[model samples]
Target: MTLSNDTLSELPADVARPGYDRAALTPGIVHIGCGNFHRAHQAVYLDDLFNLGEGHDWALMGAGVRPGDAKMRDAVLAQDGLYSVIELDPAAKSARVIGSMVGFAEVASGNAPLIAAMSQPSVRIVSLTVTEGGYYIDPKTGTFSPTHPDIQADAANPDHPETAFGAIIAALKARRASGVPPFTVMCCDNVPHNGHVTRDAVCGLAELSDPELSAWIKTNVAFPNSMVDRITPATGPRERALAQSFGIEDAAPVTCEPFRQWVMEDNFPAGRPALEKVGVTFTDAVDRFETMKIRILNGGHAIIAYAAGLRDIEYAHEAMADDQIRAYLDKIETTEILPIVPPVPDTDLNDYKQLILSRFSNPEVADTIRRLCHDGSNRQPKFIITSISDCLAQGRDCTGLILESALWCRYCYGTSETGAEIAPNDPNWDRLVAQSKLAKERPAAWLEMSEIYGDLAENAEVVAKFTALLNDVWARGSHSVIADYLTG
Candidate 1:
């Protein structure tokens, strides 16, 4: 049976469906970027809350600004906004159909429909999962880049904006003009201070056209910082097959590890669901939790990704199974990354590190190495470079951290150790490839990209170590260099 509102009762006996009345559901949240991660994480949380027969008015209305989002909107609306979440663990697997999303806004040329949907008085909250790179942050200064072409275009034509932040600003303008209260802007991305980052983007874009409106947003809007975690891989044939195995054909079935977490600041002035009743942690010190997770888990992914990518490993679990790759990850986190991370409340950092390792080792998720390694230009600055900066500030060892940077540079050369081509993975692939070629002769050339390395390039000690490690990798191969680092 095809998965839809009509076929919900026809699903397998074990597969869980919504217990509440879908017809009575109301939209309280307008979420942008309805990708795999949002479907698996936030949507699942709302699904659980609705199952408890509460927050029926807090249903999700998905919206997006990208052209690809039109495809996702079609796939989701075809099944009446119904899809399956398949949690995979080595011990067991289970499927649940999520119905928290009541509708998807039409994807149009000027985002008129999205702006109209968000301007509704009922949409008390606007959430986003637009990925780390989508925020238009300047890598060197860690501030919103108002000069970006997309931001410029939106500022020039605020009435018919093209970007998500632009549409948000347009909606807020409508709400303010028509005597409606402003909605809370919640960011669910993995970046540190994600809420603050979102506020910067939204208000920064607003400042371009209307400084008064920008001040109003800064004063009235509440952007709650959040940390979201779930090992949901990109949906493909395998995941669709898994859904079919459950006797429900779902076009966009999300397959993920059984573990999930969301640590958020309780700053929704417009109100929010009682998500704490459903395992979401609302805390004052969300930054501490954010730091622990980003450095250890996301940073750990970067730690293992380049080496595995160089060696032509397919899945993240397969890379973890490699003794050398696993050992490198363990050593880097213990010595370089964990030492600088601040104390999270009621949590042991060591135990958290172990949990991250276990999650990476879960064979059932089948998370891709390519996915982990993609977009190094954006991710390296957030995940790996921050830890290196902290270690440098405290006068600690940065040998492993610099080596990780070298591994990324080597990977950008576009070839695996096995002589296979590594297709372009980053948005700035051409520039990275050009720099990688130059760094082959002079390793400092890679660090010279001030946009990425910033003042870190001025440190003689870091420069020398990076040069040596990168040279060793190009000369003797990644395996040999890794072995030397392990023994040295």
Candidate 2:
């Protein structure tokens, strides 16, 4: 049966659906970027909370700002804001429909309705899962880009805004004027200091035209930092067919490994759902956890993705199956990456490393290398380059990271070494291709992207190794570069 409220009872008896009355639920949270990850992670947590019959007022209202998000809105709304989450493990697989989301905004009509709904007194939390690049953050400065066209448009006309953060600004403005308590802005992206960055983007953009309003926001609003992890792959025909096998004709089903982790700062002045009740770690020190996860797991994914993609590897597990790739992942984390990571409370670094590598090696998850290699322009700065920066600052060797960067440069050239035509994926795809092609002969040319590399291009030691590796990659191929590095 097609997955919807009407067909809920028709679903297989084994597959779990919401036991609580959907009509009894009310909206208290609005989530931007209603993607598969959000469904498999945050929405699942809330589904568990709802099943426990505690968070009846905290039902989620899914939202989006981009035009492409309209499709997501259509899919979820058709299912009555209910979707199936398929957890894949090698030994066993399970399918269940999660019903944490009670409603989704009319995305085609724009942000007025979204902002108006968010401004209601019933809504107390506005969260985001927009990717690292969606925030309009400057990679070089680590501050919100004041010149971002969407931000400028929002600043010029605050009421009729375009971006998600802009819509948030408008909602906050309305709530402040009406004496409704402001919603806590929670960022769930993989960016470092994600809460602070979200705050900076919203408040910095707010300050441009309304200094007093921005000051009010700075004093009153709470943007909680969070670390979220799950390997939810893009929904395709295979996932849909799997859903059909389970007697669920879900239009948009999410498939992931049976592993999820969320560590968050406990800073919700406006009240939040009891996510910690469902295995979410609430910590006073978010930086420690975020640093550990971002550097090791997120950074490690970037390392694997770029290195693997250059050799035309398809799935992440296939990449991890390679001996040299696994060795490179281990060596880079132990030496270059983990050295700069701070001590996370109750987390054994080595054990965590094993857990991450095992997750990467899960064949059932079927995470695509293309997905990981998609946004190198934004991700390289946050997930990869930041660790390299710390390694250089702490007087550690970043040779492996430099190779990863060179691999990124090579990957961006729009062709695998196998001569496979790489489709354009990144927003800065043109510049990456042009620079990468230039860097083939002039190996230093890739680092000249000051926006992406910042001063790392100018670091004599790092630059020398980066140049040498790029030259090696162009001459020796990615496999030979990894082999030589391991042998050396």
Candidate 3:
């Protein structure tokens, strides 16, 4: 028994999956930000555990803290909570059904239901995929932004909160008051030491809201840092057609490049789904893994996204296909960046770099460079800065990373090399663009933002490198500059 779509009376066979009359599993984990990444990665792992019959009692309930997620709510609900995930590779394609999410609470509707969900004792773990910027932490300073409007509003009325941090604190307060056990706060975001950052955000909010509750949360709650990876791009018409061809009526279908990895610190305090049974690695130190992904994969994204966007290129695979861009990325990673990454167990950084290039060149996924380029202010510090710092500290040159950072700032100025207007995306896009406009006049002005660049602004060598690169980028164009840096 299946529902017919209004547009296509007979749905395509490929869109169908093996029908299962599975009962609603108990919601043990409430995942915030049910975006494509979570659907394709974490939820899929949980679903695998469920299918293996180990985590059948531990399901996921989705929650959203923003208005934009209403569409996701509608899509997920329309499909009876079934979604198709197509893993696109150059050599093969595989599909899976993720049935982990059972329900959703729209936070913008009211924080009440969302908070109530968190307050539930059965929900032993709350995971997050809210992206790096969603944490509202200053990337340079590595601290929660107390002055952010959402944080301010949340701070004013601790009992009634809106931000994710505030919402978590409010629910923790409820748990403290009601004698409900504190749930593990697990962060699956890409930021380094995501667990520590999450703890800071939640406790930072709680400190302002209720000092007593803050101390209690610090004592009882657990924040487990996790490293997760899957090159899932935003799904659109092609993915929809792919799902329909697979006979799956998944309205919120997810599509990813044929690569996935999950590494976590085995530190869940309350309880967690049997994810390890489904190929997730639980280790003592995820820092090495985190660095590997951020520098190689994420850093590669930054390297190409700005240049691709500047050249008015669209898809990531398209950019990766360019010999010049591909060479530039390899040089950056292998020569300047990889040297700084701490070693991981039995992993060859060079081999990892090669795999990243292969993943980027997977045309089947069609990951857009524009998507990768979004929120540069929040991304550059995480992706580029540390490599630059490491290189400088070791008396190694950071010309490539410095140029990448400069290009990111230049890209944020809203005009591509072709004069096409880059759509605004960052939280501080307008201000950043305006700053870029004044940057050529006073190239050092943007560096004055201590919150983003920190002491990197005052480092004479960094400043000189950035200034030289910015001059070359503005004068010789991105490709020429990339060639110069790579060959120089």
Listed per model in order, the count of residue pairs whose N, CA or C atoms clash below 3 Å is: 0, 0, 10
Alpha-carbon error at 272 in model 1, in Å? 0.4
Error of 3 at 25 (Å): 1.4
Candidate 2: segments with Cα more than 4 A from true spot: 108-110
lDDT for each residue of candidate 1 in 1-488, tens digit (9 for 90 to 100): 88788888888899999999999999999999999999999999999999999999999999999999999999999999999999998998999999999999999979999999999999999999898899999987999999999999999999999999999999999999999999999999988899999999999999999999999999999999999999899999999999999888998899999999999999989999999989999999899999999899999999999999999999999999999999999999998888999999999999999999999999999999999999999999889888888999999998888999999999999999888999999999999999999999999999998889888889898899999999999999988888887886
Give the lDDT ranking, best first. 1, 2, 3
Query: Candidate 3 residues 67-100, lDDT tens each?
Result: 8877898787676566778889678777766677
The lDDT of each candidate is 0.94, 0.89, 0.82
Q: What is the lDDT of residue 190 in candidate 3?
A: 91
Looking at model 1, the pairs that clash are: none
Off by over 4 Å in 3: 1-21, 106-109
Give per-residue CA lDDT, model 2, range 193-281, as digits (tens): 99999999999999988899899999999999998988899999999988888999888999999999999999999999988889999
Let me know the TM-score candidate 2 reaches against the reference structure. Answer: 0.98
